[model samples]
Target: MKTLIDYLNAIPVEARDSFAARCGTSFDYLRQVGYGNRACTERLAINLERESGRELVCELLCPDADWAFIRAAPPPGRRRGRARNRTT
Candidate 1:
């Protein structure tokens, strides 16, 4: 089976750099993880999932983590900007 590191390394380098920047992780660190020099942390996984909308945290950190509990947690605050109030 393909490992997570393999999957991460498969991404284009430019996009990986951008994703690392958005997740507040250094590109070097990401490369290290991809190379299997360092293990991925749950916190980092969570941050990545938050920024990229990928559920890698559950897939990597907590393979058995219940999706219902994950969904029950409070949603992240507005990542782009202030919420827009709309009237219909």
Candidate 2:
């Protein structure tokens, strides 16, 4: 099976730097995460997804979490609650 690092490394060299920049990370840092030397955080996963259009969060980061619930959750620093009442 191809590891995440393998997949990442397979991308064209010319595009690698752009991917890293778009993810707001360096290739070295991403390589470390792919190698399991560093933990994959949700924020980073979201960035990667946004930049690459690949949802690696479940496969890489929160594999044990309920992804369905995660998908239902609001964005960062936000919550699901009732709206305010209108003044009469």
Candidate 3:
């Protein structure tokens, strides 16, 4: 299993800031979590999984959580950007 540090290290240095922003945190915080200097919260773990396109899965981030059910279910359709308002 790849560790968070492995995932973080795999990212190019130039993209780290943008990637961290997409995960709703600063690269410094992510670095801390990766190095085991800080705890990775459940919310952050989920966000990382979603943002990493499941490359960093919740199962890897939060091993204690029962994620089998999630894997058993089909993935939901993804929507990008803001929803358009429809005029009736």
Candidate 4:
């Protein structure tokens, strides 16, 4: 199986740093999540894609993805609570 390190290595170094900066986080934090040491939250993934201008979804679905982390991607948005109760 492919490792987290392998995936991270695949991303260009400049892209990584640019993403880290756009996320308002340090490179270490990015590494932590990218390398699977930390959880990859939806916000983080969104930030990564938005910031890095890369397709994180593609990366997550890659054959080399860490299943645990890949599964952690947030579920699709659903209407709930008052929003669902309202009859627009």
Per-candidate TM-scores read: 0.51, 0.65, 0.69, 0.46
Against the reference, the lDDT scores of all candidates come to: 0.66, 0.73, 0.85, 0.60
Greater-TM-score candidate between 1 and 4 = 1
lDDT of 1 at 27: 76
- Residue 11 accuracy (lDDT) in model 4: 65
Clashing pairs in 3: none
Top candidate, metric TM-score: 3
Model 2: ten consecutive residues of lowest lDDT: 55-64
Write down the lDDT that model 2 would get: 0.73
Which prediction has the highest lDDT against the true structure? Answer: 3
Tens digit per residue, CA lDDT, model 2, 9-83:
887998998888887888888899898898777777778766655644444553554668778989988768976
Candidates 2 and 4 compared: the better one by lDDT is 2
Off by over 4 Å in 3: 69-88
Compute the lDDT of residue 50 as modeled in candidate 1. Answer: 76
The collision pairs in model 4 are none
**Model 4, stretches more than 4 Å misplaced?**
1-18, 58-88
Residue 39 CA error for candidate 4 (Å)? Answer: 0.5
Residues forming the 10-long window of minimal summed lDDT in candidate 4: 55-64
Indicate whether candidate 1 or candidate 3 has the larger TM-score: 3
